[model samples]
Target chain A: MTMKIVFQKTSGLTDKPTHYCPGCTHGVIHRLVAEVLEEMGVLEDTVGVASVGCSVLSYEYFNCDMTQAAHGRAPAVATGVKRVLPDRMVFTYQGDGDLASIGISEVIHAAARGENITVIFVNNAIYGMTGGQMAPTSLIGQKTATTPYGRDVSVHGSPIKVCEMISVLDGAAYIERVSTHDVPHIQKAKKAIRRAFETQKRGGGFSMVEILSTCPTNWGLDPAESLEWVRDNMVPVYPLGVYKNKATGNL
Target chain B: MGKVLMKGNEVIAESAVHAGCKYFFGYPITPQSELVAYMARRLPEVGGLFLQAESEVAAINMVYGAASAGVRVMTSSSSPGFSLKQEGISYLAGAQLPAVIVNIARGGPGLGNIQPAQSDYFQVTKGGGHGDYHTPVLAPASLQEIVDLTKDAFDIADRYRTPVILLGDGMLGQMMEPVEFTEGTEIRKFAKPWATTGTLGDGPPRTITSLELDAESLEKRNWDLQQKFAVMKANEIRYETYLTEDADYIMVAFGTVARITMNAVNKAREAGVKVGLIRPISLWPFPEKPFLETRDRVKGYISVEMSAGQMVEDVRLVVEGHAQVDFFGRTGGIVPTQDEIFEKIMMAAGGVTV
Candidate 1:
């Protein structure tokens, strides 16, 4: 009997194992991006900026020329690289702590300038790398190390809705918010990533996909429970949809 | 190019362009704003780029980016802006990227006055950023030297794979003088095999990072940087001495203060005072050879500056207490006059306190 292979690893990822904890969805998100790059056939011609956080060592995992950026400065570093090499594809993989807390200014300015680059924003709603501190995207009443009494809007500011905030920028060509809770959502997330890269290939300015990810260890949940939490909790706050599409001018 | 009249900051931009610096990222600050404006108008003409970043921090980081891409990139600012750039500077040094940073000295601890001052002496020479690293600081006293050293800075940066700091003052930035640039000279190029331009699919991917989590690895990196710095010190020490051969007193200064003391030494010579001048061009390698040569014969050395005796510390350190070393400075944006410096020289030699 002859058997056909149904699944294979992507060439866009290196052989190195990731340092992310078990039950974490970062591995899934990385695979999605790597698969998209491999599918697009631009993995050889793309440069990636790995942001500071758990993904800081992502340069070791991505099968492209990579730069490890200082906390929150990946956008600025990508801007420099893309400006110098306009034909090469450039993107930044950033976490919520890196993007929303420290790097908010860099992303805002990159969008304002309409810099031709892609941004992969992973929102786990907590700082996973530094032992589960509260994050800028942490949901209301969420309990973390810093917010032991649960997040209070009276004390801490509201969780930043990055897609909503970034979609309003004139320079942003494509903006979407996706989730990684289940198979269907994960497929949709891959499609969004492909579109963002496609936008960049066609000289679209400032494409971003804010992926609602799961942090099982940090969130005090099992791998299965984390997916349920994202679907039940995060999806309500960060709705899954394309917030902006410059090509269609549709929300 | 033949001699043409130009402002100090414009000279810096044009000289950098001549040196093959096709990319400039900077934020607008007083004194150094002319350099940014000049690059804005000039870089595009040469098919280069000039990006005005949101802040000096972002500007330096942009330079860091371009530097990682193996291009001759530059960013400039005044005192407070330079302070903001310290974080990126440390990153650039830690990553061992080649770039040039210009600090047009101004009065500061805060938003001090916009007038020219040498208050950043300690900040520049003592390694302004946090790291076990040093940047080769180049001090150009005249517009002509600005043309020469600006190009040298780019070359030195690329040669060592390190950031180079070019020190100037508000006087150097705003003043006008005639300068001749060596146009059409072939810019020197260094191959950067380590730059991250994307993988070629034939090799493993390259990662450009400064983070070394392992203690031994980080310590080794520090040692490698120190070894590189030793080579720089040995090969890059640059300074000028005038009449130190048979002088009774040697006066030390740099940048604009050097020019003033030069004139002061000349007038004192006409009055038959045995005075000389020594100006350090490469401030970090802090030219100790001149002091070593004249220390036994000279009665004392006076360090003059636009600030409160910062470089004098180095002068004293180099002299090794062999002779009396004194400091004369005018802080808070005051440019010391030639006559005042000449009188100080005369006072050290004799009692002529004019």
Candidate 2:
């Protein structure tokens, strides 16, 4: 009997091993992005901007042309790349600390300018690279290194719902919040990533996919429990749905 | 081509466009606002990109992005705005991306005023960003020189694969002069096989990054950068000497201050006082050779500036105690008049005539 190969590495990804922690879900997100680029036949024409975070080394993982940006400046850099080479597809991979905390202005302004680029935002609700400090997206009752007593709303305020905030911008043509807590949600997240790229390929203005990810190491949970944690805690605050899709109707 | 009188800032912008810089990102700051406005109107006509970034920090990062894509890009700002861009500049230097930056310096220890000042001489020439790196800084004294330097800056940046700064002051930015746009100036293009514009199956995908987690690798990168800077120092020192031969006193100046010092030199010569001037065209690989060679002959050196004696430090370093180096400056946007500079030179020369 002849063995038919059902799974093989996509050309969009490089041969180097990833540095992501086990059950971190960042690996899954990376694979999804690479697969989408390969399937869309834009792997050779894509330019990826890696933000300063756990994914700071993402430039090595992506097979397409990549540039590493300073902490929180990925969107601005992506804006430059997209504007200069409008025909080339550009995207930024940013984590919660990078996209929501220090890089808020860059992300907002890039979207507001209607820059034709895609953004893949990974929100794991904590700063993963910097040893689990309190992140802007840390849950209200979640315990973190800085928020050892669990996040208190009176002290730390609330988590920023990025998809909702960005969807309201006039320049953002597509904005979706997806999760990778379950196999079904992972499939849905891949679909959202594809749609975001589709928006860019079709000349639609700023598109973003905010994927609710898990940080098992930082969250002090085992691999399996971390996915459940994301499903039970993160999904309620950041609802899994398309906040704005110009092609379809606004939610 | 016929010469047309244009504002210095406008000329710099137009010259950059002529040099094939199709992407410009900047913010509005006085003394350099005209450059941004000119780019806004002109870039579209040439099918280029002109984006007015929200801040200078964003603007420089945009330049970084465009440069990484293997294209000519630039940004312009005044002192405070330039300070905000230091972080991005450091990244660009670390990544070895080629780009041009223009600083129409205004007065500042902190937003001092909106007038011309050379206070930023140390910050720019000595690496304004947080790193052990040097950006090749070119100082232009006239509108024509500004245009020429702006064009040359792009080429030099590409040649070295490093950021080059065109450092001017408010006077240089706001003043008007007749600039002849010379056609067919030799434009040199460098091979950017390292740029992140997709490899197109030619090779592995390129990565432009400055982060090296390993201490040994990072140290090696720094050493390599220093070697490149040393090469620039050897090949790129530029200065103009006026009546330096058979003179007792030499005034070291640059940019607008150099123009004023020239007037002072002529006045001192009229009074039978032997005075010459050394105008440093490139401030980074500062014209140390001129100072060293003339140190023995000149009685004393007067460092003319529009700040609180910044460039004098570099002069002193080069002079190395061969002669006394005195500083004459008018700080906080106060430009020294011709008479004032001449008087300083007269005092430095011990009230003696040749």
Candidate 3:
């Protein structure tokens, strides 16, 4: 019997190792994004904007040209890049703290303007880079560093549903929320990533994929348990589904 | 081409187009909204981009992105809006990106007013953001001067791989003057090998970032920036002198105040008082040579300004006890008349209270 290769790394990813914490789902999301770009034949003509969270160093892992934006400014930067080079595909990779807390205006305005770009939003419900603080996406009862005794909805407010908020904008061509917990869900997340980039390639307008990710270290759970935690706690609030798909009229 | 009467703000916008600026991102603000409007109408015609950004902060970061992609980009705002752009300006400096920023200044400590004032001299020249960096600031005294400087700003920014500011007051932005765009303008092209444009099989991908986790590396980056500023200070000092050959008193001013002080100098000369004017064209490099050269010949200097007392500190530092330096100005959107500045010059000359 002849041995054959079952899998290989995509050319869209650099050879360098990632700095993500062990058992964090960020690596899986990164691989999925790289695979999507590579499969779409846009890896060479793509520009990536990296945000200011744990993924701040994402520029090193993405094979395409990358520009690192200041905290909460990636969408504005992506708008700039896309406007300057409309033929080139542009996307922003941001965490919940970057996209939901501080960068809300930039993202909203970029979508409102119908900027033809893509966004990969990783919602892990915690600020991972600066320690495990309560992110804007943190669940109402979730315990974080800042919320040592579980988040109080009355005090801290409910988790932001970014997909729902962005979907209401007329300019948003596609919006979806997917998870990266299980193999089946991982496949679905990759499909959403592909659709987001396809929308940009076809000049469909602003497309975003909010991935429900896992932060085992920050969640104080082991790698396997974190996935279960995401399924049990995050899925109910986030609700995995496509919020808006302009091509399919699935709003 | 004959001269055409143009508003200062519009001329700045047209000049950026003539200088090959392909992207413009800005928000609306007083005294400078005409600039944004002009770009909106003109950029699209020339196959360029003009985006009315969500805010000044977003506009500046957008400029950062376009500039990193190896294109000439610009943004304009008034005082308060300019204050919001400082963080992005610092990041541009840290990333060594070339960009042009225009500030049509208004009165300010907070939302002071939307009238011409030069209160932002220190905030601009001293690096308004949190970093060990400096932006080369150019102060234009008239509509034509602003047009010329706005064109040259792109070149200066690219040559130094740093941000260049065209600092004008509200009068400069709001007033109309005869400007001939075809004369004395040189079009030069620059190569941007460091831009973050996709490699496209030409080379490895480029990464434009300001973040450095290691302390030693960050310090080294800061030192490199300081060295670039030192070179700029050495080679880019610009100013104008009027009748300073045989004077006992000199008047120092810039921007719109410089033009007013020039009239004041002529009036003082008619009264048999030997007074001259030193108008600094570049505020950061600050034309210190003029003050150093005239220190011994002049008995005293009167610093005229639209602010309380901003540029006077720089004049005092350059004079360094060689002569007495007195400050005279108005504040809160108030502009001193030519007669008011003349009286201050006479007061400084005679050592009498005015």
Please give, for residues A63-139, the per-residue lDDT of candidate 3 as tens digits: 99999999999999998888888899899999999999999999999999989999999999999999999999999
Model 1, position A72, has a per-residue lDDT of 91
Off by over 4 Å in 2: B351-354
Each candidate's DockQ score against the native complex? Answer: 0.76, 0.84, 0.84
In order, the B-chain TM-scores come to 0.99, 0.98, 0.97
lDDT of 1 by residue, B1-354 (tens): 579999999999999999999999999999899999999999999999999998887788888888888899999999999999888888888989999999998997799989999999999888888979889999999999999999999999999999999999999999999999876888999999888887767677788888998999999999999999999999999999998888999999999999999999999999999989999999997898999988887999999999988999999998998999998999999999999999999899888776
Tens digits of per-residue lDDT for model 1, A1-251: 99999999999899999998998899999999999999999998999999999899999898999987888989999988888888899999999999999999999999999999999999999999899999999999999999999999999989999999999999999999999999999999999999999999999899999999989988989999999999999999999999999988674
Candidate 3 clash pair list: none
Model 2: colliding residue pairs: none
Stretches of model 1 off by over 4 angstroms after superposition: A1-4
| lDDT, candidates in the order shown | 0.93, 0.93, 0.92
lDDT of 1: 0.93
Tens digits of per-residue lDDT, candidate 3, B229-332, equal 88999998889999988989888999999899999899888888999999999999788998889998789988998898999999999999999899998989
Sort by DockQ, top down from the best: 2, 3, 1
Q: What is candidate 3's local distance difference test score?
A: 0.92
Alpha carbon lDDT at A221, candidate 1: 95
Q: Kindly list the per-residue Cα lDDT of model 2 for residues A1-251, writing each as its tens digit.
A: 99999999988899999999999999999999999999999988999999998999999899999999999999999988888788998999999999999999999999999899999999999999999998899999899999999999999999998999999999999999999998999999999999999999999899999999999999999999999999998999989899999988673
- Model 3: lDDT of residue B288: 90
